[model samples]
Target: MYLSLLTLNSRSKRALTESSRPYELHRSLLKAFPDAADGGPGRVLFRLDVNEQTGSISTLIQSEKKPLWTRINGYASFVTECKCKEFKPALSLDQIFRFRLRANPTKRMKSTGKREGILNTTEQVEWLRKKGMNNGFEIIDVIALDEGFVKDKLTDTDNTGHNTNMFSVRFDGLLKVTDVDVFYSTLRSGIGSAKGFGFGLLSIAPIKE
Candidate 1:
């Protein structure tokens, strides 16, 4: 596993567009690994860092071979820096860590059998509660950050050809790793849905002893 951090040029239009749409960014990330196929289950998890001024991307890419930094044309200039390092995962039972994740909280409607996002704060928290239970972790002092709809240049046909609205909620808290295996899988595969659109990337830091 390799973790890469890329600093992007914010002024570039292509950068702005790609930053807004997770689907496009996924494609952009694949360019780093020439051997990776364009379509299939992805081995990469990415999250954007946006502030008042600039934005950056941090990606956890799983590959046996080192990746080559590939830039998109006309979209933006090449990444300012591609910092990469070999990653080795270490875990222990009942370990606590400071965690952060941008997740798309949603559930299926029992009546219409349709998938809808949970935008309500109480419901979103409940959704996370259930998710944590199933994923073998517990949230301690978690707060949710609302990041409204993420509109893309293209509309989703399944969504009545309307702009696919993704309700992004950022979760920050201290968590105890219960089931080591499940926690690892959650970190790799991500939490809820809309992963392609930048929803489910789990970031964590060891608690200072």
Candidate 2:
């Protein structure tokens, strides 16, 4: 797997425009890997982080293939720095790490067969707990930050004229790996839904004691 960090120049008009539109931003990131197709091998996952106070923008991208960010035209001017590195996590059973996941916390309504965002904070935390159980991790301690809704309009070839509102929540905490194999898969495949629109990328670091 490969991980990339792109620090964008928030002051640039093009950067600001794409940042506001998730679909456009996703398209922009895909320029890094011209040969890769969505939902195919080498699937790309990304998360956009914006510092409201500082007006700074940065994005983290994870993929099965290495990305050549320079392939994108004029992308260098929009970014202050771009870094990509190989990511291979050496995890053991019962190993603990600090983790952050920006996910779309939701549940499907049985009657309507449609998914709805979990609005309550407690329920949001429970959502992550359930995910950890199935994903081969145990949540030792965690908190959910309600990031509200991310509105996106699809202008792409297939989904043109479609609009979507995705509720986003940031989960941060310490978790212990219960199954190394399963945990590694979770890290690569990510967690939750709406992955294409900047949700479900899990970032973690070993805890230093």
Indicate the worst ten consecutive residues by lDDT in candidate 2. Answer: 34-43
What's the TM for model 2? 0.94
Name the best candidate (by lDDT): 2
Model 2: which residue pairs collide?
none
Cα lDDT of candidate 2 equals: 0.89
**Candidate 1 lDDT, tens digit per residue, 75-149?**
237466667787666889889989888888988999999888888988888888889889978877688888887
TM-score of every candidate? 0.84, 0.94
lDDT of 2 by residue, 1-209 (tens): 99999999987998998788877888888877845345443678899988999999999999888888887768768888999999999999999999999999999999999999999999999899999999999999998898889998887677568789989999999999999999999999999999989999999999998
For model 1 the TM-score comes to 0.84
- lDDT of the candidates, in the order given: 0.73, 0.89
